[model samples]
Target: MKRFATLMLAFALVLGAISGAQAATIKAKGQWAFDFSWLDSGDFTSQDDDGNSDDDFSASQRFRTQVDVIASEALKGVVFFEVGTTVWGRTDGALGTDGKSVEVRRSYIDWIVPNTDVKVRMGLQGLSLPGAVAPSSMVFDDDVAGLTVSYAINDNVGVTALWARPVDASGNEGSDNNTYDEVDMFALVVPVTLDGFKITPYGAYASVGKDANFTGVTNGGAEFLSGMLSMTEFANGAIDSSSSTYDAWWGGAAFEMTYFAPFSLKMDAVYGSKTADDDAESAERSGWIVAALAEYKLDMVTPGILAWYGSGEDDDLDNGSERMPSVSPTGWGVTSFGYPGSVYRQDTYFGLNGAGTWAVGLQLADISFMENLSHVFRLVYMKGTNDADVIKNNAGVRDAFTPGNTYVFLTDEDSAIEVNFDTTYKIYENLSLVVEMGWIKLDMDEDTWADQDFSDAKKLVFNFVYDF
Candidate 1:
């Protein structure tokens, strides 16, 4: 990976050299950041759920920059680099001490088809698949290396597609494992706008050629339980972890309407599924996810209602029901270990593909209080759709590296409640300060964990960011 990064940087420099013949332009952007937090039982604490002791606070500081080069009307390129070890998950890279965690974040070039409305982008980059997209970082956000194409259908519509690889297998076969081919992906997205409403619909199809190393279906950030179940099957000694390949797909429509100005609605819903190669595991990979937000705007405040649900693995494996599963590259990323972009904050225990779960919440945002200053608050109620959870158990057994203070603290409880608020102040057009805090408590179904005592968690964070 280091070699590839170096090569890409060298290639971009050469491209810029040749562009001097035309009107070439180069620009750089940079950001410095800091985040400090009071430790909780969540990550840093005096005592862990497993009763271990730790620090009561944490802090992170970093700087990042990106260089943009426009060689011509049809050609452009970008180089991104960052230095820092971050616990806040705001950025992606290796953890470092003594100031050595610096790494390349993105290196991609964009090429436009001459005299046409089409363009092609290749290399390491981030791409957004627009549609009824949820805000869950582990489900909707994706950054990858590969090729992407975008063509304008018209002023109101456009189409985009991708061909990428999420996982690479080195062809090393062992007694229980065979190095498999890389996981390949193909996706198509169409965005359209009519009247005051904008809607994006997308469909994605991905597969693994051979071997069973492709784990998007069973072990992506959202659906870690699927692969876990296959492990529990180990007791039966019938299913080897690498014994099967799978195909998975996602399609959905995202809705947004602003014609009403003060009154608007936003929604994104998708159905995802996974199946054993050749339909061998007929009982797995079926689910749907939906989230909708409606708000009424006032002179200085906005009040909104939020609702969401993501299907989980069914207790009856043979039952004809679908659960939502995210692609491997989706989320903060196995590659980047990045930060959360939605309400499914990384500090929280909720996994996007927990299968049978739902939430209803209220949002109150105040923007009129001051210039460059705003406050947003949310109160949410979360619950399960199933009577009992099988995926949680399966994931519990399969997850060996996760810390007990982290995922293990998540119970079979059927419900939870969380309240959070964020206050932001823009010190300058390019600098901002934010303070975000939250309190989360577990709510359980009497039938699932009748006597278990789950502790509540809270967090207070301070962030300062400067851009240049």
Candidate 2:
């Protein structure tokens, strides 16, 4: 009798498992990209270990896949994984090809409130503030573990709020770990739409603990934060570091007008500030940025003019930096080689945001003479807005300010011109081949670089992409 009862229980459990599996649907999609590229940085001083020059040509590939389990339109869970960029002939992708490169890029769940219009997304996910620009946001654009909630009040208005913890040093067990060793941010955005126009205004605030370990943060968080702190009292004078925290805030608005078909205009403006909790005069930094683009779409091509300017550093380091502070800017400009133009597998400048500069460009995009083939041409002139006195008067600031990607850091007398001609041809509905060529002529001030010869930067790339 006891054996009979055990068998019956096992059968019931199997039926329940089958019922649950039938209630949810599974879906999957992903992309694969392979690249053959050559890049000449034009910096003669660059060398690898053993005092050897690094190679400029390489082949690499990346793959990403996302799986979704959905019960309904408003309820689903997603898990995204990536085998990140792996260079050919490297240990990871060589003959053995046994590299442990697989990473969980994102994991999240989306659900709506019962009988309500409010929706919530919770987990490690991508977060980007609204911007009129095509590629990315300047202030904050990255993936972090966070909770986001959104609601649509009507057809013309909506709101979104988010809370994210980008860094949490409390997980470590050491002197650097403390109760306040973490960074948290809160933000809200209100979007309004009317006919052919739309605008989104946003505000965000962050609390940075004094002992927070920025080195663990990705996308150049440590570099930018340390650079800004160098201009403040904490780095130059005696201050009670244990009792102080940093407060950072940003406000911005993005606008777009497309009421007139075939012609459109877009603009983005933002201001940012950071200060110590004690409000030290030497610990305050603030700046602003404005950018605009106007484009007219023709039958064969779309011509556009883009321009942007950002406040740069003044001569007084003791008064703090005048240049704007950013979280993680993607640095998408007219060309991929000069700036971190929006491209797959080529976003090499992981954390260097292009602040303290100005630029103007003319773009001819979507230039296609044949089906399934397209081309883009861009010419950009860029210069720095920072006063040269900051580097001239300060000692060691020049070398310390140089990040991994040294192409975009310019001074008042420094300038560069970039040109890009890229082409793409679709082989199938989900496969394409692309070739990109780029060049930049640098004009560095002799007095600043101390007679060092700066060569022109060049790039040639071939990419094969497949998506589903």
The TM-scores of all predictions, comma-separated, are 0.79, 0.91
lDDT of each: 0.61, 0.76
Which regions of candidate 2 deviate over 4 angstroms?
1-11, 42-54, 172-177, 217-243, 280-283, 331-334, 348-354, 403-407
The number of clashing residue pairs in each candidate reads: 13, 0
Q: Score candidate 1 by lDDT.
A: 0.61
lDDT of 1 at 102: 79
Candidate 2 structure quality by residue, lDDT tens digits, 1-468: 999999999999999999998899999999999999987764523454336776899999999999999999989999999996899999799998998889887899999999999999999888877788655677777778899999999999999999988777667556644656777889999999999999999998888776664655555454446334535432343222644578889999999999996999999888988777775656667788888889999999999998888888888876777877666654444356665673564443212344678888998999999999999999988888888777667655655443342334578988878888989999999999988898778777777755555566777899999998
Lowest lDDT block of 10, candidate 2: 231-240
